[model samples]
Target chain A: MAKQYEFRIKGLPYLLVLPQMVIVFIFFFWPSAQAIWQSFFLQDPFGGQYIFVGLENYRVLFTDESSAYAQSFWVSVVFAVSVTVLAMSLSLFLAVQANKKIRAASFYKTMMIWPYAVATLIAGVLWLFMFNPNVGVVAWFLKHKLGYEWQYLLNTGQALTLLILAASWRQMSYNFVFFLAGLQSVPADFIEAAAIDGAGPARRFWKIIFPILSPTSFYLLVMNLVYGFFETFPIVHQVTAGGPGKSTAILVYKVWRDGVVNLDLGSSSAQSVILMLMVIGLTVVQFRFIERRVNY
Target chain B: MKRFSLLMLALLLCASTVFAQIQIDWWHAMTGKNAAALEELTKRFNDSQTAYKVVPVYKGSYSDTMNAGIAAFRAKQAPHIIQVYEVGTATMMNAGGAVYPAYKLMKDAGEKFDPKAYIPTITGYYSTSKGEMLSLPFNSSTAVMYYNKDAFRKAGLDPEKPPVTWPEFFETAKKLKASGMEGGFSTNWISWIQLENFSAWHNQSFGTKNNGFDGLDTKLVFNTPLTLKHLQTIYDLSKDKTFIYGGRENKANPLFTSGTVGMHFESIGGYGNFKNTCKFDFGVARLPYYSDVKDAPQNTIIGGASLWVFNGKPKEDYKGVAKFFTFLSQPESQAYWHQTTGYLPITVAAYELTKKQGFYDTNPGPEVAIKQLLNKAPTGNSRGIRFGNFNIIREIEDQTWEDILAGKISVKDGLDKMVNDGNAELRKFERLYKK
Candidate 1:
């Protein structure tokens, strides 16, 4: 009778969460574990054979002089971090501006979010045409209006600029939505009190508004960084193709290339495991060092 | 009461089984006009046969179809037949028991499946050394040059005569650009047409052992000076704006058809689209070559895709597939397909049948691709690439071209990188087979 009581008390939470737990284990956690397991093996694309090589794939990924693996990994980090910061900052600025009782603020807010409605694939296609060397409107402006002999598609720096712009454009809208919601929830009495203390717009923003928006910024940064690596794949593949000599080859694209394009599941899995480790290590570092600086 | 209920259920099952038709589902990547043609063909086959019903479903693109098939196979829910692109041959061949060879399927169905019936150059590429035909040929095509006759005439060049060699082609391209054409010369499938097909047409090995046909241990051999020089030619043209670099693959076709480009080198499948579009006068010709090489020009290889039957299909359904293939290979059907679409006739008899019907005379550019392909038997290099992971190799080539076009890397350096990286992919594929 005592054991039954213990079992009933202990197993109640597990019983309640069983269905969700099973789904998470089967679909998410299982694939991740298998990916880690596959990282230790080498797979042949043609014959579908697997050979255990004990971190050889990782070794190739980390230290290979000629492979694009290391380059893509570093690029992904830079891309993710830069896009996250830029998007968060821009969204915060726009959200603060729109929070006021200015005329037509709703109209401005609505227009800012229009880019989020466009699918990444469709956006990529539109960007390709917009950057076309011969017929693109941007090309015409660069050559004729600005008198600059510039092409965006083939230039690495310009290509990256466009990619970040497109990525940040969508992300800024999402961040704006979140930050606006967070800003609205910040209790209007606090903002009114700060303004009564002879604080300027800049001071109020830095002292009161921004401090409260820190949590929202942190959340948006994490989500945007993850999207930059994973969700950005369709746009990158469709537009740049990691071209101009692999200037924009990100980590997740490398995983997709290795797995789907090359059919080397082992190498792809190794890339995935490495990417996971990198994201985790990065998150931990940020929490340890940067979280302390948060005003909240 | 329970026994009676179970007996009734069994009887109901038996009754339904008596009149039920064996359904075969096919997944293909053909869309637009070609999709319509395929639907018509399948509908005709379904009407002709009562034993089995063949259903054709349009999957998105070539890569999408291949990925879907791979995922389905992993889930044990694959369709009966899948139309795999030419580049995916290696992946499909390496699938082992997941696929059923057409030879085996036909034999099991007590149907006559002859490898000799197909064009040697086309069939040999997809067949094993044992001469087993693994897949049935569907929409076979080859690369050809599409020229804007109006642009040529405006440039003071003959609208009827196309350049025969690389030097002549380049010279004409310069002339076309000098004539103040907005876009001079562009190409689709830059990697496929320029690198892969360039190597084939020049009889140069893209990889060792005739592009990995002999074994998986094949290495990339596309870094030779000849290949580098050819790549440099295009790269130099891009720098000069004489050659307009379009998107990576299949992205330049619309530009050509829309009259933005004076000349375009693309797969012959563009015939239907170009015919429909292109308000300007246009002509098609054989792909140009480098005159310096010995026996420089050769018949170009096929593009498009093939229909591969899967393992899980029934014997009766295989009979239906065979019958459909035979019907597809008929002279009238082949002529209609060739005349209407840009794909080449797969069978020699159908080709001759098309010629006898004077379809070529009525439509000038339609016959140019077939004539280019059948002009000579494909040699070792010109036949086709059979290496595993070839699609990735093409991806590497695409990036290399981008690098060259962007002036980020020298032509020689780009080709060297392509060879090195492509060889790594080949080695990876080879290890799979050896194991």
Candidate 2:
């Protein structure tokens, strides 16, 4: 009952994928392999020489007596989870509002998507300007009108909160686009039938629209986690610099600070490998468990 | 058409000839106004010579520039020269076969270089224990106290006489606060000013082995009774809102310049920024010391960048580098740079030249930094600190200090943690460099 067709060209498939394969190997796999190799060795800053010290770097990181490594891991988890939840919920809410048959909906959608075009670092700088304790307009208002001394510079909790808000603010636009698309694709007739059956807006959204959007939501959850974990470095760097006493020093920020600023290539590489494993483990769990509930 | 083609060919040939000249690339981390000043100096060097053209490239911040330089060196495309920050000195020095020491390069190139010509506190920082200069000191500054003269006058303190001792400083801060100033005192570079320079300024050892100058096996010893007393003073000050913890590393500069904080401790290099920004007159003074400590008020350490020559460059490029350094060393050029940038004059001759030109008479603040550098002969501890992995050690210090300030840990516990964490980093660095 099966029909097979062959072009009789042995190298065509390979030829067709050669460019992408070459790019992926050169850009991704090669560097990752190099990181794995470098993680096993202690190297000078200038790369003049290297000594293979087999797992010493990992041992030092895990056995750190100061608990900096462990604390950064927890900080990363809190940051990534908070950013994902905050960004996703906010974007979903905005998408739902924009999906309604309201006047100037297209204009609202376009304006909402404008933040996606701004660079991440610029977004961070903008937020910094607004929240800076000394010179920020919002800080001035909080100090003068609201009678609240907003000192993120000294308060670790406040600094972390500011970073989360800034990071999630930048990510909202990206999640909104996906969520809006997902909401649009949900058949309107289902909602109409539910309305006819006396279902309220909240009930319809909870029972019908949310399940229909599960696939997109799951996809976005994974993406937002990765973004929060790895790609929020610029925001941290530009805003808090993982400071106010290392309270905001996330895992990825530590990797950069150690590798680039401190020039400890071995430790940085080991941390990168650890982060890679974490992401792999997370993605596997998501696909195995969360994907089961994602309808289609 | 034939004549037009010939003219175009002539222009192309001329352009190629210009490009053929050895281009000495100098990667630096200067940005904004400083970048423009650096570019002007480079243009002067280029116009002054036809044999070599020194091209300056703006390469992000200090750490970013160092990373880029390291990556480029690995790719075997390193620049001829790089501007390394003061903290990166040890790393650059230990980068075997990757750099040509400034003294050796100058000597081998037969340049008329005199190590003694530079200010001792300035050159001693980038030198070996034997006083051999490892890198050419370009822009150097020492920590000093910056006071708002208007605020001091308003607080009924002598505007001309800044507090010279810790007790006096605290009293003045209280007075400023009593005078209704929002912030009485703050500081930038807490670790650098409070601990490192504080130890050096009191002639107390910050670490063993001459502040890590002699070898890589140095351990941090700044967690002493003296440092504890100073930190306790700051802690008490913070309790009363007299001393505002203005984040870290020049973040407090705005508090001083905005006239909110009456007194601020910052690098003398902040002169230009303060002069440009502060609406009220600001005065520079030597960093305060504990009055009870004998031999207190030793020379403070330098805290700016230097020009390092990398290896694996053409011999001609080395010669160009030597020539450029010679040009920079000229008294006129050094004085000009000092006047413009507010960085200390590297050479004694430059200082004398600047004084002879009556620059200090009109601009009184810069002389304080220069005088602070030349205050006394640098003792063992007063000489700059040079330890491997100092960058990480600095982070540890900052974190510990923050913890102490935030009341998360006791002063002794925080300082003890700093020593432990810093020693571990040093051990790691020693292992890496041992081979």
Candidate 3:
């Protein structure tokens, strides 16, 4: 009799997030849990029999030298960091240019984002054609036009550079979109204030604009690093096949080769769990140490 | 009332008789030109006799088709026939009661199937350990060298003569590259053609007991000086920009046909595509060897896939499949298929018929593959690998080869690592079965 109860006010947040939570549970969490469970068992593909091996699989994962899981981890770290830095630098430069009143800005925007709209697999295929020593456009240009001897497939340094470039090319667009949005959100009044205080354009950008955009930069850095490790496999397989030797054999590709192609679920799963823990720990450290410095 | 009841009963009997056309499903991975031929064969069979209707379904690539079949089987809805690659042989063989061997099925269905009628080499690969045919060899191919005639002419080399030894191959490729060709040489399935088949072609064991002939206890043994020599040459060629390594697998097929590469090593199954696509004349030759083994001409191993009959089909459908197998075995049909597609004649009779027809004499290219295959009888290792989880072993080999070419690891260490890793995979597979 005293108080009227409101149904909409208390349960609104839950209602808003219920669909996404359900989706995450079903698609991501459930499959991950199942893979973890399978890592502990030996599965018979013929009869669907799974026998638990306790920590035997984990022990094998640690002791398997032929797999070189440790080497893969190190390679992945280097690949992730280099790709993140390169992609971030490029995208920031593009965003800054697009923000200014430049000629054909709209056309430039479309051209910059065009690669992002293409599928990763298709991009790999196109890149492979361009790098083909026999018929690749770039190979033709390098050898015939420039008169420099080049074979991207056989050279280790060149192959790795090609992988980084292809990876960065696809990623820079996503970074550009985020940076552009962040740039737009940066208050014009703040830049004017900095200028009035006798700061130059470069100084205004470095001190005033960059610090405000730190949050977006940080977000892009973490996401890009994770993607460089985990998501670049299909492209790598299509493009280099992790060659001119194993120069491009990063961690996720190793896990994929061990798991799907090799059918050694135990070692592959063990690698997956370790990789997950490493990523999670690194992410936590970043948030603890770096998140505080993000101005937003 | 009695007359009306009798009439109704008669009508019910007529309705049940019309629903008796036994339906059978076949899931295959044959696509492009091969698919067109398969459709022609199935259509002719369907029109010839109306006893049973065989429905053929295209299910993408070999691995994709097999995965789909396995999933469907678990769902209790697998096709009557599934085309599985040779690598999946051990998996199917270990799948006890899941598959009905062709001979057993034919016999049980009151059909005659003499396994001896097939080529000994062809049947041997698909047979059980006891020499019983388990599956039908549908489209088998082996690695062979394809050279551009125009490139050879431009390089001032003999068009009819191909490199018989590895040294000659390298020298010739270098010459072609120097003559301003796009690329002197490019190879596909570098792992399979250059390493796995290279070891087998030389009669060297890639693993113990001729690449796991004895079973899961097999260990790697390919870290030899000869293999090192072969790999070192490839690395040197890359430095010289004479020999180009294609991306992976059949990625280099188009390079040869597009006139971008002077010479290429690819599967004979790709012959159909090459023949159609190559604007300039091209020729086929047997794979080159290192000129060391006593009996090095022991024939190149096959690369294409075979068809396996699965269980869970109706009794009447087995009869249709067996009859279709017999029809496909006819010499004229085999010859036609061999001439149209670049796959080998699957039977001795087909080979004889093709020779009598002077098909090889007219077509110099198709004869090269046959002469190479029949050059020496296949032994255990050269016959083909059928180890449990051999697919994984192939992947490990692929990774190891990549490492070797990258200069990240020496060939000896790379192959040694591959062997150790491959054996571990086999042992894990062995453990799964044992436990």
Candidate 4:
């Protein structure tokens, strides 16, 4: 048995971590608390006047089906889930291939990882140019080469598809780096032993390699979900601007539009408070259920 | 030696007092050529004065500037003068103690400011119901139709005579589409051109309480039979490919510039850009009206930004601001800005000066804006509409309008949804101010 070590100086441990705690408290907890406090009141833009009305803002936010909030909720759901699953799976597949014995391995890996260096807003704008209906190269090819009508500006489904594709394409690079690292860290002896035991390649990957990568997979899953929830706002903003009848209006986009653009603070704050709760619940669920299956 | 040094320091302090000029902060959202025009005006003002120096700072886009100004005000570091867009007028007005009304400022400074000296239609949008000027009008524009004269000629229609009625306009559009054009006429600002200005031009109220001018208890009334008819007609035309939906908010401008479409509706301020970019001949015409409406084609409302002064500045600053406004209202400066920037001249004297200089004859495109705005005295609806959250309301307008064209919602339902959502925003604005 190894020696078990414990810190008897409780004050020293708290003192050592005090700086990070202060940073998180000031940056995260303070603003979240303010958002929750502001959600119950109808406020002006400059906070010149605020009238308290308990739960009225939250009620109005969820009640307006015709106001496009319902559609936005559904869009946010589909957007987050699809982007997380598609980006993770696709990057993982590419990472596995890039991990194999192949020619010019670093070149393929570098090419795959280059998109991570591009800003999310820049990525969105580049995709927008490529998919522009009138003069874009992709649009022209789709119409002239494939003989298909690609009208994203007015088509609801097409707008969402383009938004998801742009967001997923941008997200895949980040996922690829982690997945490649995780694949490379898997020991070589397990694979050779499984191969010697007469197991096929599919069986080895599913039973051994996949189980070993669960820690990285779980971390990526949590990260991708949180990112899908909040960080895609700029891409949605520059690309579609929550148009084509609120089809691409994600929840965070609505928060910015209402709070920042329209100055509807109460509704915006209520939406953000809901988003805060959602993130908290997601983190709890992921750590409680998913972490149990993740191998150390 | 100490006595000699003290005497020298006293002399230096006296010299510093004589050279110091009061610097007033002026935040604006003008970019590119517009910023250059504003800089020239500032240079002229600074050169003519010794006691005050005006400092103009570019603060990003209109929305960014407005938000920055508001945030600054909250921090008690607000600029002396902030240029706010027309849509931001309502929010600025409701800022209450944060704003120093232009009329009050002029009176306090004892400047010789006449409310009647300014164009009624131009100032009407920025004035109270009692005709009190809230913010000084700096740059103003109105909607006008720009048609490809070459496309009209190819369609066997008279280039000199553009369509005056809605029926005639659609007929001409169909003809142009048949004449080998890619699509029919598209519009730049669909909500402003189709709904807001549409109701005003037809002498129909956009909302109760004089389009939110009389009181804060106003709700939108734009879903009437006539407006519904117009929305439905546009929807049908879009389905038939006679009216191309070229995205929203001036994204369709290239359609007109590239000669992909026949006619386009855009702000009169776009004249300079269109002149530089268009490869074909274009003519400016008044927006088409429905013949059946009784008092159709009322004057168009202004669409550009205005200069607003914030409160809590020193009294000396207000006096300098008044002097600046006095200089800005001069006919020469107004005409120079008007001719250079393509925004309308706010004062009648400047208009006359530009006309006397034969500016209209050389540039025929801008004459249509003045003519359309002076068609008749503005009624309650035609004056202007002011409501809170108008920016997002415009987004809602664009989205719902596209939804109608996409067949997701009927025209009637879409129009109703717009009115419903718009009224909800208005109610929120009312609550914010009424408190």
Candidate 5:
């Protein structure tokens, strides 16, 4: 600033932001530090004793001959990219339709946003019921009507597709809300001018509207990627349980399975650390490259 | 002044009574009907004594409860008693100073307990290599065959006779499938029923060192010719949809109860749910085994949970725990528990008591699990498996089996993968516990 305006008291600014700092430090930093510290040690499930064996956990993870760790990484990547693209594109389509001045547009918008109210686990269960090979209605239709045996329990591709659809279904509403807000912010005069210049609806959307929505789309891309990576555990757990053969066991789900179910503390903690680094790296890249393309 | 003094004396008497009774916390994972039954039993134990009061707290699922108990132990606020599932037996046993062995708890408290009173197959699972019981067997169950008798009659097979051998079972499944049944046979807990209990029931070694009883340096030996033969048979059956792969762990129960699947393999613990849900007549039979093996159909291994006493509680609380265990061990209480929950009566006296009372005559399927357990003296291979990282091992087995069923891998390859992955987990557990 041209003129420096300082706090009257030495510690006043620190005091003013003390509550948020305390919350962030206690909830986020503390647990992350604990994970980093625990990643270096081998501990029993009871935590009665621990021995520091530096880098062994990480080494085991990277060098695992079964390639389960590496497989889960690729699974996570495929899952995240598929869910983000499907969810964002579908929601954008719906948002564009809802942004029209048609009758009952508000009603359409309200109905489209209803899925956001469902908890992730509940959404997963709902999809699971619909896709259950034994008694699922849709499965029954596919089998009886189409003469196709719908068996996701044994088909890796089918299971992955179900997970992608369920995960995207739950996230679509959130993206729709943001996309609708973004569409509303685009000045109508721009579209009108493009229309007067003899541009068709599709051409007007591509040339005038979509460029202005780049900032919102970029923001959603990052958010959707993170959600797909970390927040799809419930979907995978309830629907496929990372099976027919670990086909859907993403990195985050593996971390939970090892750490919580198997009680392999060091290995799971190492996984957590690696996942944290990957996300950090991803976000940095997104801001560096993708943000440059945003018109805002 | 006289009335005030009388009131004070009454208050003092009440306070003294409350202070004299030791309170013991019992953390359990029983839910729904079983939970209510547990609450009733706890109330009975409390009312039957003036020296102690045991409060039963509902923890989440079995694994969640075990984790919570471990966390509480680390915090030095552990409950006096915890109900740990059978898979967690090795973990609890290796927890060294964190637990007081059940036999020692009883002996130290000067309570009279006879390990011989319990069914040998039931107690053998939770006992040390030296045959010392480490945890009190509670709600024990074993895998068995469940059949829809109505489906059998509809398919023109004898409703009373279930297949006693694997070859016969497969033939019957083919017959049922030919009769237009959608799913002829299915199984829950494929790894438990098809692998662990399958090996034990066939008198085949599941692992070296008597299934990891002697030491932690155990390797899975279930990839034997017999196991491969059986898996290959199942694979062949699956090609025609005669054998449906029900998802893991009791998920197949609904298929059987809904009468969609003709025959099902599940735990005896599923008896209550089937009896209540199935519209058709559901029957229980012993698990099928290969007749070619000389020592085929040995006793099956037990599942379900046991009561483990934790260390680091007051002496008085230990005394209360011993008393609670004594009450649970009584024949009447064990029989009641068995009758109500469809779990096995752990003790011989309870089994005999229930039989004498003609409970088995009226409820025919409840006794099948008991008979399966007491059918023969358990050999080294048939007793039970005690291995580190068994939960993870079970997961790996499930994955491999699914892969095999899905045609992603051959049966031999799947079994080999299971063994290799299981051994690696065992090694990791060995290293961790060595600390």
Candidate 6:
């Protein structure tokens, strides 16, 4: 049965919603508007002088290959996709195993979620130390014992891989928590019936639990994409700093490097505007396509 | 008892109202021991005067400090002073009405100021075409070669003798390698130490318009044969691991400190950090030159930050800032700063004071940078690079250098690409602040 609730006063409803709207406008809309506005003008870092340059900032970014903003776009795509797929699948697997009624399952679940507590930048630093070529425990083992060279310093692929691993490791816990909840909520009877009907464990789970977990999966997918794009900036900043040579300069880091570090206000603003549009387009596409598959 | 307590409270209020110290906020980028030294210096300044309290706030890295200073200026809450790195000089100088020129501040405050009293090379960097000082030269450093004496010993080379020329440096590197060192040598700051200073050291122009001093529309001219040959030598060395490419910036520092590399090039300001970290006996020497070029091994340019006064502060605050700057320039204060931190003493008096005290006898490492800076009177190109968007340009240079070394691009092509790309950035800067 659906329960209908009504506010006592019309003014009360507006009052209740006013604070959220104001917060959103101040934090999100206002800065976004400013970014869009600033994109049209060239200004010094001090905001002392502003010259209107039309769309020159955007033109420079799009045309200048050496600036590497275009390269950052592809880097971000690979980074986001790799991070999303890797974190999602690994967490799903871990959640599935932890879903069993084994002894110390709660302890195992808690241990898996511990990485989620580390801040992104801190996690990056931790991962950097662990994978540092000079004197890292893992790096030492790989070099001395396995005799496989693991130098991320100059290797673009290895650097990106290490960053992706660090990024995915921190996020796995959050995905695992959601996946475990989704797994626990799956009706046991449906699973049992599918098993009784001669469907194997893989088929039964795929047909039954997987589709039922679609809602969670869709939500995680969108969140993970956003996380991959924006939240991974700290990790990228700390780990490689877009280095080995602009090989990992993702979009967000470019925006920060230009705007904050180099004080290129106009270009960074343009970048942020483009980044905003890109993410918005991405979210819209996800909801349109991915959400349609999420039954119930 | 209540009446007596009320009387005491009234007295305290009167005291607070009567004696108010003008708080001069000094935002700086110095960290660790340098920051501690700055704080102590600030305490000394505060103790010496009752009219002003100079509070030195450590504002992250140099870039972060510059950003914060600029952002705060926009908000009309700017500090009295901010330390800007040498590369940021162009950006800071171009910000009209955003900064109060140091000479003007000193003149207006009626302070006994003489720009020539400071080291010519130091003041020459932060000055205008008229040779008027723009900002107070605070902490300056130059590139120097830090050699591991133990590695030299292991290589059977004389520990006291370091390479004097580029060819000799490479030869020593070969010797180190033959003696079984993992990496013979490496360098830090591919863009700064290697290219920019490399040009100046060899009496060559890094860019046109006297390295952006004459005009904003400066074009890079460092893609010459000399620069190319230098890069080629490093590239060839890197092929055999005689010269290990240590990522970018100071990332190669660990290679030297790890003791596997014999000689490393870095800022002399790294003195404090190296002392703390290096387990082996290390010695600092002048950066090697080609030795074939005329006036080769000319004075190197300064790195590190300078104290810049923000615009639009109250008149009294500017006066206090002027006074505080005067305090920092005193021989004792400058010598202390020079000794405590690895940064150079900007004034001749401080340098003489330090020498007389025989500070160089024990800490000869820092003297190399000082001597490098003062080796010869600065020429047009040797004054150091001053171009806007240099931070971004440095990144481009770093990326290009790495690409060339990694064999992704040929040395000539990479240098050409760097020049082309860097010129575009300079054009952007020229357009932004074009008069």
- Residues B79-125 of candidate 6 have per-residue lDDT tens digits of 99999998899999999998899999999999989988898888888
Q: How far off is residue B313 in model 4, in Å?
A: 1.4
Model 2 gets an lDDT of 0.89
Q: What value does DockQ give for candidate 3?
A: 0.33
Top of the candidates by DockQ: 6
Give the per-residue lDDT digits (tens) of candidate 3, residues B15-130: 66645756668899988778888888777777777776778999987877877777788778988888888888877776766788987877887776777777666667777656
- Please estimate how well model 1 matches the true structure, expressed as its whole-model Cα lDDT: 0.79
Q: Best to worst by lDDT, what's the order?
A: 5, 6, 2, 4, 1, 3
Candidates' RMSD to native: 3.9, 2.1, 4.8, 3.1, 2.4, 2.0
lDDT of 4 by residue, B1-435 (tens): 999999999999987875577778899999878899999999999999898888999999888888889989988999989999888989999888999999999999999999999988899899998899999999899899999999999999999999999999999999999999978889978888888888888989998999889988998999999999888888898876788877888787877887878999999999999999999999999999998999997878878899999999889988989889899999999999999989999998998999999999979877789878888988999989887777877877888898898999899999998999888778878877884
Model 4, runs deviating above 4 Å: A1-22, A285-295, B1-19
Candidate 2: TM-score? Answer: 0.96
Q: Where's the lowest-lDDT run of ten residues in candidate 5 chain A?
A: A287-296
Task: Give one digit per residue, the lDDT tens place, for model 6 in A1-296.
Answer: 79977988879988989999999999999999999999999988877678998998899888966667778999998999999999999999999999988999999999999999999999999988788776567877887789986778778999999999999999999999999999999999998988889999899879999989988988898889899998899999888888777889899998998888888889999999999998899789887877577656
Native contact fraction (fnat) of model 1 = 0.47
Model 2, span B1-435: residue lDDT tens: 999999999999999998778899999998877787788888899999798999999899999998899999999999999999999999999998998999999988889998989899999999998888988988888888989999988888889899999999999999999999987899999889998999999999999999999888998999899999888888888887798877778877877877778999998888888888999988888899997999888888999899998899878778889999999898988898888888888999999999999999878888888888778899999989998888888988887778788789988888888888899888888887875
Q: What is the Cα-based lDDT of residue B30 in candidate 4?
A: 94
Better of 1 and 5 by TM-score: 5
Q: Tens-digit lDDT track for model 5 on A167-273? A: 99989999999999999999989989889999999999999789888888888998999999999999988998999888899999999999888888898999999
The worst-scoring run of ten residues by lDDT in candidate 1 chain A lies at A1-10
TM-score of each: 0.91, 0.96, 0.87, 0.94, 0.96, 0.96
Interface RMSD for candidates 1 onward, in order = 2.8, 1.4, 2.9, 1.3, 1.3, 1.4
Model 3 CA deviation exceeding 4 Å by range = A1-25, A47-51, A147-149, A272-296, B1-19, B166-186, B199-207, B223-242, B253-262, B289-292, B353-362
Residues A54-125, model 1: lDDT tens digits: 988888887886567878877877888878888888988888889888999999999888888988888777
Q: How does each model score on lDDT?
A: 0.79, 0.89, 0.78, 0.88, 0.91, 0.90
User: Per-residue lDDT tens digits of candidate 5, residues B125-239?
Assistant: 9999899999999988999899988888888999899999999999999888888888789999988889999999989999999999988998899999999999999899999
Best by lDDT: 5
